[model samples]
Target chain A: MIILIDDNPIDTFIQTKALELGGYRGRIEAFRSAEKALDYFQGISTSAIEADSFILLDIRIPSMNGFEFLDALQRLDKEVVSTFPVYFLSSSLDLEDRQRANTYPNVVGFLEKPLTRHVVAGLPGIRKAAS
Target chain B: MQISIFARKSDFQEVTHIKGLLKEWSPKVFQYGETARVGKLTREIVILYKPQLTEELIRIAAEVRILSPSCYLLVIGEGIPGMTLFHAQVNCALQLSEIGRIPELIHELKARAERITSDGGSMAMQELQEKNKELEKINFELDRFVYSASHDLRSPLTSVLGLLYLLREEVKAEGAQRYVSLMEESILKLDNIIRDIVAYSRNNRAGLQIEEIQLPELISDVEPGLRYLETGEITVSGCVKVKAAFPFSSDRNRLVTILNNLISNSIKYRHPARLPEIELNLERNGQHIVLVVSDNGIGIKEYHLEKIFDMFYRTSDHSTGSGLGLYIVRETIKKLGGTVRVESAVNQGTKFTITLPLAYA
Candidate 1:
C-alpha cells in the first residue's frame, strides 16, 4: 500500500498518476493535510496495515507539520509504529531539512519534488508480479 | 562640577572643612534625615558615613543606584570597609586624613564626563549599538523570507513541469505533440530563470558550509539534473578528470552552484555543427584546489568576454537564459575567496579556471 500526505491537490494527483505509470498495483491512499492523515492513522487497527505499507510525507503543511505529526505518531502503539517506514517527498533543497529528516529513525529516504517514474520505481514494496 | 552632600546636623564642622577643600565644586548640602525626600539625583552625591546611620546609608545608596544607574556615589568616613561600601553601590570612599585626594577624585570625574560628552555620550553609543542590532535582525529575517519564498515559488513550477511531461506522453497527434514540447521548453526556461534567481539570492545571503566533497560525486550529481537540456539530435555530455593528491574540503552548496551554472551555460551555447562536450578537471595546486571547466561550444567574442560575469549581462541577442547564472557563479567564487578567469575564442570554445582555498577558516 502507498500512503501520500501532501496539501497540494495537483501534487497529490501527479503522485497518484506517477505511481500508476510506474506500475504500482496496490492500495493507494492520499490525504490533503497531515492532520487528516494522523486522524486516519489513529482510527485504523494494527492488523489493517500490511508489511508493505509505507508513508510519503511532506514537511510543510498547515495546522500540523510533518515533524509534529511524527511526534504525535510516537504515542501510538510501538508495534504499529514499527510495522511501516516513512519517507519524505519534498521540494525543499535545504541541507538542514535533509539532515533534520534523517534524525527521524523511521524516515528511510528523502526524494525531491515532481515525483517521476524513475523515483517511483526506486520505492520499496510498491511493485507486484503480473496477475 | 556640582556635588550634593548628605550628612547629619551634628557634623557641621567637618562638613565645613570638607566644603573648604571642594570649593572648586559647588557642593549642595542636605540633612541626613531628609534622605527619603532626596528627589531626582542627576550628578555626584557624597554620603558622610555615621556608624548609627549605616543601614540607612546602604538603603539610600542602593535606591540611588537603581533610580539613576549612571549616577556616581561617593561615601567618605570610617566604620565601613571599601568592600562592604561597594555592596551598597558606593563608587569609592576615603578616611578623614585622606581628604587631600578630593581634587584628584573630582578631576577624574570631570575627565569621565568629558569623555562621555566627546564620544556623543554613552547613551548615544548604546542607542547606536541597539540600532545596529535591530538592522542585523531585519537582515536575518529578510534572508529567511527569501529562502522560504523561493521554495514556495519553485513548488508550483515543478508541478507544472510534471504535468507538462505527463501531457507530452499522452498526446497522440503530431501537432499537439509539437505544441506540448514547445510548452515544455518554455516552462523549462522559466524554471531555469527561477532557479537562477534562487541561486543568486542564496549566494548573497547564505553562509559557507564546509564539507568533504568527492569530485566524481559532485560532477555526477550535477549531470542528472541537466539531462533535460539535451534534446533532438544534439547530445550534450560532461567528462570529468580528478587528480587529487589529498582530501579536499570546501563549501559543498557553493561548489554545486558554481558547477551547475558553468555546465548549463556550456550546454546552452553548444555548437550546432558538433556534439557539444563539457570537460571538468580538478587538481590540487599547493594549498589550493583548482577546477577548470572547459567546453567546445559557441564561444564568446573578445569584446563580450570581460562583461560575461557582470550581473544580467547577456552575451548575445539569441540568449534565452535569465543572465544571472554566470553572475551568481562569479559572486559565489568571490565569497569563497576564490578567483575565476575566462579564456575563449569565437566559434571554438570557452574555459573557466577557478582557484579556491583548500580549507576555508
Candidate 2:
C-alpha cells in the first residue's frame, strides 16, 4: 500500500502515474491534507495492515506540513509508524529542509519534484514492490 | 567659533578694538551690512552702537533673536539717555569706554556655544532614530509582500505543472502532442520565474546561518537541476583541494542558490555547435573561499557584461532565462558579504569568480 499526501491534486495524479510506470501493483491512497491522511491512518484497523505501507509526503501543504504530520504520527501507535516508510517529495531545493526531513525516523528519502519512475524504483523500501 | 560684528561706519575704531580683543579666540568674524540679514546669522554676534542708532540696533536684535534664539548677542555703546528698553534683547551691555568688560562678553558666548552643541547633537540623534524606525517598518512590509506573492504565484504553478503532465498522456495526436509540449515549456518557464522570485525574497529576508560545508557535495546537489542537456561534459574539479582541514562557513542555501543559478546559466546559454562544458573550481584563499564556475558557451559581449547582474537583464536575443537568475545570484552573494566578478567575450566562454568570507561575522 502507498499513501500519497499532497495539497495539489495534480501532483498526486502525476505521482500515481509515476508509480504505475515504475511497476507498483499495490493499492495507492492519496489525501489532499495531512489531517485527512492522519484520520485515515487512525481509522484503519490493525488487522487490515497486512502489507508494508509506504507514504510519499510533500513538505509544504495547507494545514499540516510533512514534519507536523510526523509529529502527529508519533502520537499514534508505534506499529503503524514503524511499518510504514515515509518519503518527502518537495519542489524546494533548500538544504536545511533536506537535513531536517531526514531527522524523522520514519522518513526514508527526500526526492525533488516531477518524481519519475527511476526515482520511485530507487527508493529502498519501494524497490521491492516496484520491481 | 564664528562671530558677526555689526556697527555704523563711524564706529570703525570700536570694531577694530573689539576684533583685536577677541583675536585670541580665533573667531571667524563677519561685518553685518543689513539689519534684515541678521536673521540669517549662524554665529554669535556683537553690535557696537551709538545713541543715534539705538532704535535700529534694538529692531535688528529682536529679528536675530526671533530667527535664532540660541545665537549669542552682545551690545556695547555710550549710555543712551532715553533708552531703558535696550537691555531686554542683547545678552550683555557695556559702555564703549568700558573695554575691560570684553572678557565678560566672551564668557557668555562660550556658554551659549556649549548649549547649542549639546542641543543640536540630541536633535540630530532623535531624527536618525526616527528614520531608522521608518526603514524597519518598510523592511517588514516588504517581507510580508514577498511571502504573500510567493504563495499566490507558486500554488497555481504547481497545479499547472500537474495539469500539463496529465494532459500529456491524454493527448496522443502528433500536432496535439506538439501543442502540449509547447504549453508544458511555457508553464515550466513560468514555474522557473516563480521559483526565482521566491528564492530572491527568501535570500533577502532570511538571516544567515553559518555552517561548515563540503564544496563538492553542495555543487553536486544543485548540479542535477542545472543539467539542461541530457548529455554534457560538466566537470567539477578542484574538489580534492577543498578537504576537511579547510574550514568554510556560510549559509548553505545561499551558496547553493548562487552555484545553481550560475551552473544553470552556463547550460542555458550553451552554443549549439559544441557540447556544453562547465567547470567549477573551489579553493581556499587565506580567510576567503573562492569558487569559479566557467563555461564554454555563448559568451556575454563587453557592453552587456556590466548590465548582466542588473534585475531583469538578458544578454542573448534567443535567451530563455527568467533574467532574475544572475540578479539573485549577485544579491545573495552580497547578503553573504561576498563579491562576484564576470569575464567573457563574444562566442568565447564566460567565467564567474566569487570570493566569500569563510565565516560571516
Candidate 3:
C-alpha cells in the first residue's frame, strides 16, 4: 500500500496518477493532513502490534508537519516503528530541510517535489542492513 | 530518560516510592523489567536501622519474598527472604519525552550497594543531553540569522520600491508603462533577494543583541502599514496583550513595517477571488507570551513550510513576493529573544505564532 500524506489536493491527485502510471496497482491512500494519518494509525495498531507500516509524509501541514508526525510515530510501540518506513517528501529543496530530516533516525529519505515517474520509481526501496 | 536511583530492600516499597518519583518524569520511558541486587557476603559487616527508618522497609521486603542473584540488594537495611528466589527489584522505568535521538544507557549494575545511584550511566546521559541542546541552539541561530537579515533589508528595499512607485506614476504613456513594469520586476527580484538574505542571515547572528521588546503594540501597529496584492480586513481576532521584555516608546514606523509585512504576506498569498482574512491574536500566561498572526489565503504547501523563511525560496509561480518578510520577522524576533513558528495548509491558510519572553513590560 502507498500512502500519500500532503495538504495539497491537486498534488495528491497528481502523485496518485503518477503512481498508477508507474504501474503501482496497489491501494493508494491519500491523506489531506498528517493528523488524519495519525488517527488512522492509532486505530489499526492495538497495544499488541508494536510495528507500523511505511508512510510518505509532507513536511508542511496545518496542525502537525512531517517531522512532528515522525516523532509521534516513533513514540508508538517499537513494533510500529520497526514496521513503518516513513519517507520525508517535500517540494522544498532547502538544504536545511534535508539536513534536519537527516537528524532523525526515523526519516527514510528526503524526496524533492513534483512526483514525476522517475521520482516515484525512486521512492520505495528495501534498505539492506549495513554491516 | 527519567532516573529514580533510590535504594530499597524489597519490591513493594520501592514500587511505591518509584511511582511517586515518576510524577516528575514523562510517562513514555516506563521500565518493563526490574530487579534488585543482594549485597556481597565476602566483606560483610552489618549495620542496623532503627524502628522508624528501617523496620517499615523490612516489613515490605518480607512480603515480596526477595533475594537477588547478585548476592546483595541495595539490600542494606536488613530484611529476611523466603524459599522463592524472586527478589524485590527496584523498578526504574524512565519516562523521558520522545523528542528525537535520546541518550543511551551505559551500564546496568548491581543495586545492593550502599549507594544505589546510577552515577556513571546517568552522568554520561546528562552530558549527551547537554550536547544535543547545544546543537539545537546552533540550528536555532541559523534559522534566526536567515530571518533577521532578510527582515532588516525589507525596510531599505521598501524605501527603494516606494520611490519607484512614485517614479512609475510620474512617467507618461505606454512607453513609460514598460519602464514601470521593469521597475516593478526589479522590485520583485529585490524582494526575493531580501528573502534569501534573511534566511541566510538567520544563522549568522551571534547571541549578542538580546533584549525584551513590547510586542503587542508592535503587532497591532505593524500590520496596517504595508502594501499587499490583496488588501483585506486585518483585525485582532481575540484579546491581545504585550509580549516584550522592556518598555519603550511606541515606534509606529518600525511596528508598521512588521505588521505591514505580515499582513501583506497574508494578502500576497490569498486564494484567487477570495478576500484575505488576517488576525493578530495575543495570549500571555506565566512566563511566556504568544502573538499569533493568522491568515486565510492560498496557504503554504507542506513541503515548503520549513524553507519558507529560506532566502530566495518561492513555492509558486506568483511573482509578487520579495520572500524576506518572514525571514526578517524571524531575525527581529530572535534579536528580541523571541521565536517564530508557522502552521499552514495548502488551501486552508497559514498561521504564524511568534513567541517572546513575558518577564518584563
Give candidate 3 misplaced runs (Cα > 4 Å): A1-131, B1-179, B191-216, B219-261, B319-324, B331-338
| Docking quality tier of model 3 | incorrect
What lDDT tens digits, residue by residue, belong to model 2 across residues A1-131?
88999988878988998787667878999999999999988888777774667899988787798889988888887586654788888775455577798688878777666666555665665677655
DockQ rank order: 1, 2, 3
| TM-score ranking from best candidate downward | 1, 2, 3
lDDT of 2 at B357: 86
lDDT of 3 by residue, B51-158 (tens): 122343343342221122211122232322210111233333333232111122111212332223333434434555788999999888766555444444553454
Which regions in candidate 1 have their CA more than 4 angstroms from the true location? A43-48, A51-53, A74-85, A93-95, A122-131, B1-133, B217-246, B267-279, B295-303, B344-350
RMSD of each: 14.5, 12.1, 24.8
Best by lDDT: 1
Best by TM-score: 1
**Tens-place lDDT digits, model 1, residues B118-151:** 6555554565578999999998888767657767
Docking class of 1: acceptable
Q: Poorest 10 consecutive residues of model 2 chain B by lDDT?
A: B76-85
Selected candidate, larger DockQ, 1 vs 2: 1
Which candidate's DockQ is highest? 1
lDDT of 2: 0.68
Candidate 1, residues A4-114, lDDT tens digits: the string is: 999999998888888887778788899998888878888888878876788988888778888888888877665676446888887665556666887888888777677
